[model samples]
Target chain A: MDLDLDAATLDFRGEVRGWLAEHVPRPGLPSMDTAEGFAAHREWEATLARARLSVVTWPREYTGREASLVQWLVFEEEYYAAGAPGRVSQNGIFMLAPTLFAHGTAEQRDRILPAMARGEQVWAQAWSEPEAGSDIAALRSRAERTDGGWLLSGQKTWSSRAAFADRAFGLFRSDPSSSRHHGLTYFMIDLRADGVTVRPIPQLDGEPGFAEIFLDEVFVPDADVIGEPGNGWRVAMTTANNERGLSLRSPGRFLAAADRLVDLWRQRGEPEWAAERVADAWIGARAYQLYTYGTATRLAEGGQLGPESSVNKLYWSHLDLGLHETALDLLGADGELAGPWTDGYLFALAGPIYGGTDQIQRNTIAERLLGLPREAR
Target chain B: MRFTPSPEQRQFAASLHDLLSGADTPGAVRAWAEGRPEPGLKLWRDLADLGVTALRVPEECDGLGAGLTDLVIAFEVLGYHAVPGPLAESVAVAPALLGDGERLRALAAGRLLATVALPPHVPYALDADVAGLVLLVENGAVYRGEPETEPVRSVDAARRLFRVAGTGGALGATDGSAFEAGVLAVAAELLGAGQRLLDEAAAYARQRHQYGRPIGSYQALKHLLADVVTRLELARPLVHGAAVTATARDVSAAKAAAGEAAYLAARAALQVHGAIGYTAEHHLGLWLTRVRALTGAWGGGAYHRARVLAGA
Candidate 1:
């Protein structure tokens, strides 16, 4: 297998490198979890959209370059390497946009994608309820048929970015008799609709990084339904796979972190105790990058992602946690204080718990990929 | 850039796998351990006839003229079969060290067998009794030697290790690439061994019943095997990527990752097999011991980690 980027990819890299160098916000935008920071990040996203750099792999009509997946990876590498601000609209642009392109009707795409790309409408995932964190199919959220739309009634907890997001998309049981992945309808709901409430939840770093969304008979127009009604389970799997796969946690972020880790180790006089761990972190990141390139190649060759996404999710979760843990270990006593390392460590702790808990991911890997028997439900 | 193996490479691996599946590799491994090397050597010749021995040798030397990536694919299949030989030395390292020589031609043609002792890290020669040639590498210099040897028992019975004494005239000066190739070969082998362990354990878990159901249904067993699967899957790309790059740092990184992943798989496999895996009669023990032996074969995890950190 060849590791060298083609001339076209190299040229794309140069273009993205040049553009990001010039337009990436200096001093970086503030963390997007806070309300003010959210507004600033949204503005930054608008600037990116204006420059047609918000979604490099999407169609040009959606403010993208229609770039190849390899070029998109290159763009991510340059973006993270430049120390750019995190995407405030990632939940929309990365997770939802792909699902929309794949399953949304043409009208839905026209109405939602460009706005999402421009950061005019930020999205949050509303899949997990208080009782349905990992076993999401056990969710009791219901969307009942109404005259012109459906009335959504449910509670969705751990809805990341929901506190500031304009809308949310999730699965609701549309058929009263259905249970466990059956007869669910995927709907996009306006957070500002009547009978909806969003309560910001303080995370480990004391930021409102997630929120609890309560829908009490919130009316959603039929136009907002993604894919056919009563087939939400199949439709939502695309978004879940995206969440756990390459689109959400690109290897660029980890590679950038690894570089920073090496720099930290060098600055700390290369402490003997931390050296192996530092090397391991770097190696893991490199392995992930190569694996992702392989995956991108496979997808480009028309392969579909399946249970293998669970493997990726399990890997990056641990890699992220380990990288941050090593950074803290190098920081020593100062790591106890509030800093980027400490903040990142706190965030990394959430990796294994979100998108699907590690336990659930393990089960998926075993039952699906390995052809093992399913455990008792 | 393509990261997965090409279709041609996959076909080669599949062919090798078919041959090994029918080769009675376990019997050959046992025969070798019992000091009957003829059976194992016969299988090795069969592999050589498949051009496994000639992969990394240059075309000028009457060899296949393939790259390290091809050697990695061959070595991984050999590891999966637990093939009993100094495969890394004969197939990968010796070609890099003895490039274009008559001895290289003989080695590639399967007319000779070679074993190496690279000092500091690899102070012992493996299968020197069966080898037609023995080489010593010290401080970047290669020397032809018929050094005195003292037997050292290995955890893997299929492997016969010995400490060498006395060095002969210098053959040539070489860079670190040969050593790095050796490391990458071992990493590939470790990846294969880990994959085998995962496969065996997964199959066993599917059939072995406990608590009135297959053990595979238990989360404990499922999670254990799943962890191994993830480690092996992630480590594989590193092995292939290292073969592509063949730099010291890349090779060392591959070795470190493959070694750890394989060791973890061994542990998980034994755990999943329960008492049966501990018995000598089971083929699982053969792979278990082989993985243990290979984990520190070229260089242990700590050494590879230091190499990676040193940016070598």
Candidate 2:
């Protein structure tokens, strides 16, 4: 009911805002949609990591300031408000951190958490196979049991950042005889190992952030297996939940975009009607902020992941796309051809497809959230 | 940094839910909205007692002064209930009219009812013989008017609309601010109506079995329902944010954005509900009518869009 931040939180916002004003990266870096852009993004993350300002939500034990979730959100808002590149290693900060904290052994956590926090390593998700995108449980990547280790073999497509990643966390079929969901095992495998091949996929935007990985007899020590054997689905679910639920976009970023868009709309000799669309976009952005706050609140309250997280994914992806679309619409022909808006528009299209498609998110909502009966074959 | 409602807000919202759950029942809302003789006195009085009628009014004015955020919560509940009344305008818009203490007190007491009239459609608008005041904007001047007609039947059977003939006693407030707030109020109300339609469709999707399973499970219905929910979520925040920032150093952006969100939510809601949603006997059509009325109720989305563009 109350949207106003308290005095302390507001003060925290001011501090974060002040920090971002100085540290935002320069303009000559690679564009975010391109491979070079991701490299630049990583460099920016390393710079922030050096300052100990990146990924504020994790505990201080892991090189984080151990800031509260509210402060973390403020950090994001301020960071985005400053036009800084998004965290380059989000697969590390947002996804892997939570997964390792929950399931990794203490020694594993000690080894990975600090290094990941300091940007010493980059992680890619090796989940989706050529045939198993939505039905992730049907993964055919094999991990054979061995003395004190496991041997991994098979391919993982849509392996974001795998082309340059130091390591990957993947799910593999460890037992050929077990059921589809039960035979899976989760492992953190070094991408530099022998017999690992990574080839980047060329996207429309010419980004090589996504790659396909072919593993032939790659070895992973049993110590790197996350959780128990056959527990990969549960661990991967935890990762996916973090991917969908806890990840967020700062409202200030969109607000800043709206500010620029309003300027762009008027500069083109357009009428004031575009301002309303901008305002609508602002509303969508603000709503997304509120939605993220709700998710964070649940996490603070120790709530478990539920179907409502799908609602969050479904809602925000469309919101992100809609705001950019409105920006493009306002720009008319100019928006379609050039500038940040065009790139944003293209990137936004992937919002629904990545993480989970809007269709799949809705299915989750229907079957799980609403408890509707499953579709009859 | 956090944008969601707090625990306290949730509790306050629950109060609204509890009160409006009965007041906004589909039947009652339809009865009054179509200008049927139902006054909805019981629900109104209950709301007044619960401090909803005076939520946005300043405490110095013998009201709660909970501000727009509180009003957002109240109206969202009202929308959820689909209570066919000018509750948002009466509470959010009337305070700006500078009406006499008696009128404000009556409004706060749930004994008085008020609604704002813009252009293009005027029903039994001047018929305030049974109510405390009628707020109308004419020739760009906001006037407190009195009408001689009774509440008349309309496409939306749950709301009462009156047609005013002449401007009554001037309440002395000529500022366009109140009028703009009234428009935004309608927008917020429409946001609520859209949500109601979405809920109806979702519920129906769960119960309406097809091919031996809930229709919601089918791709066709799933996509439709998902689209409706997406639109609803998109619009809900816009409306709420507009309310939050309406008193901003600049208000046009919020109003314009809210105007679009309102219309879009209602439109998508109707689309999701399909045929049964269009019937007069059902609450879906009632929401559709309210949305239609509210779409152009004030300056409208097009006009507001222009305003926003001008601001930009």
Candidate 3:
């Protein structure tokens, strides 16, 4: 019920505001999918790592500030408000870090987290295969038990960040006899290992934002296995929730976009019929910001992250798309030209498709949150 | 900072739910729509005994003197039950305007029912004939209004609207806090109404069969209802947040979101219920039409959005 921040949170917010104001790059960074931009974005992550801002919620030993979730949210708000560069280590920092903290061993955390925080080991996700888009449990990737580790052999399409990321993580079929979410093992695999081939795919924006990771027999050490071997389904479920939840997409990003959209509307002479849409963007963003604060508070109160995460995913993805579309509508004829607005609009298209498609997220909300009848697959 | 409801707030809402659940609210609403205010007024008296109408009245006025958050908590439950009356007017607007007086105490004690017409924002006095007091707000001035006029039928049959005319000198000066409180109060009602619609739609989907299976098992209807729940869930926090902050910017944002979310719920519920929901005899129409009425009651989406644009 209380919305006022404590003194410590306010102080932490002031510190983050000052740091972001001074260090955030002017003119912003290029797309992290490109080679030069990837290197530049990686350097930016290293700079943030030195300041312990790269992973604000991680342990201090891993270059994090040991910040509470509220402070982490404040950091994100300031980070986006300052127009900071995209996180080059987001795959590991946002997605895998939480899973590792929850399911990986202490040794795995000590070994992997510090490097990830420092941007020394960038990671991509190898979840969706050509045949296993939304129904990710249908993945055909197999892992055979070897002398010291497991040998992975499968093709993973839409492997985000694999175009330049150092390592990737995915679920693997380990028992050979089981299928469909059974006997699967979660593994962190090196992209540069022998028999691994990364074929970069140009997105609609003509950037290698994602790739296809083909593996003949990529070796992953036993230390890389997350949770129990057969319980990979359970472990991967956590990652799915994280991917679709507040970790991957906080309301800060949308709030920032909303501010930018409002500015755009003013700059464009406030076109008719666009006022409602533009204002709607602001409304949706504020609603989302408040919604996430509630979510963070619930999580802090020891609430479990469940299918409610899909609610966040479903809400923001549509909001993001609508915001960008509003920006384009404000641009009018210039909207057709390939520019930042167009680039953002194209990127927002992925919002509905990735991190579990909106349709899939909606189904999760209906069945899990509302206790509706499950779809007869 | 925390945005979740407190234990007391949760308990208050639960008690309201308990009382309203047994109040036979549908029958009361039907009576009120037919100009028989006895059933609805009886429920109002019971709610007042529970201190529902006294949430915003100051302590000196013999009331609880609670904050806007508490008012919204009460209003939300009232909307969930589809309670018929000048609820926002009596509980929120009246208390905010005519503070620390016998009128306020009377409202707090449920001895009086009131309605107001604030020009531009609220041009019509809702349920004016049944009200013990009808007021007009114009140019920061509050005046007594004549309410025994021709009735203007509202979208929701239970809401009796009258074009109230200002008849006397200013009773007092207002800083327009009443309108702001009314905005947030109406937003909470819209959110609750939408939530009820979503819940009913979900329940219907669970039982209503189509093609040898529950219609909820169909992806098309399921996805439609799912989107409705997402919007309503996100909108819920906005109303709660605005209630806590009570800022003009936050209030507008809350109203805009709740209005749109409620309309979406109404549409999705009607689509799910098909022809049955379209019938006035069905209870779903109460929530559905109440949502439609409340979305534009205090400040329409466009007006609120303009406020948001101005503040943003």
Query: Of the candidates numbered 1 and 2, which has the greater DockQ value?
Result: 1
Q: Estimate each model's TM-score.
A: 0.98, 0.88, 0.98
Candidate 3: regions farther than 4 A off = none
RMSD of 3: 1.2
Model 2 Cα lDDT, one tens digit per residue, B1-312 = 344555777787798787666454666665554445354656777778888887756667687867666677667677666665666567777777654777777777677777666554233452243346667766666676656466655555455566765465554645666655665566566667667766676777778765676677777666656655655654565555556667432244444444455556566556656776777666677667776765655555656655554554
lDDT of 2 at A370: 53
Please write out the lDDT profile of model 3 over residues A1-377, one tens digit for every residue: 86888899899889889998899988788899999999999999999988888998888888888888888888889888888998878889888999998999999999999999989999999999999999988989999999889999999999888999999999999989998999999999989999999999999888899999999988888998999887898998887888888888887888999999999999988776799999988989998888889988988999978888998898888999999999987887889999778987998899999999988988888888778887657
Q: How well is each residue in B1-312 modelled by candidate 3, as lDDT tens digits?
A: 888888999999999999999989999999999999999999999999899988888989898999988888888888889999999999999988885499888999999999999989899999999999999999999999998666799989999999988887888889978999999999988888888888899999999998888898888988998888888888888899988888898999899898888899999999999999999889999888888888888989888889999999
What interface RMSD does candidate 2 have?
3.5
Deviation from native of the Cα of residue B252 in model 3, angstroms = 1.3
lDDT of candidate 3 at residue A276, scale 0 to 100: 93
Supply the TM-score for candidate 3.
0.98
Ranking by lDDT: 3, 1, 2
Show pairs that collide, candidate 1: B249-B312
Q: How many residue pairs clash in each candidate?
A: 1, 25, 0
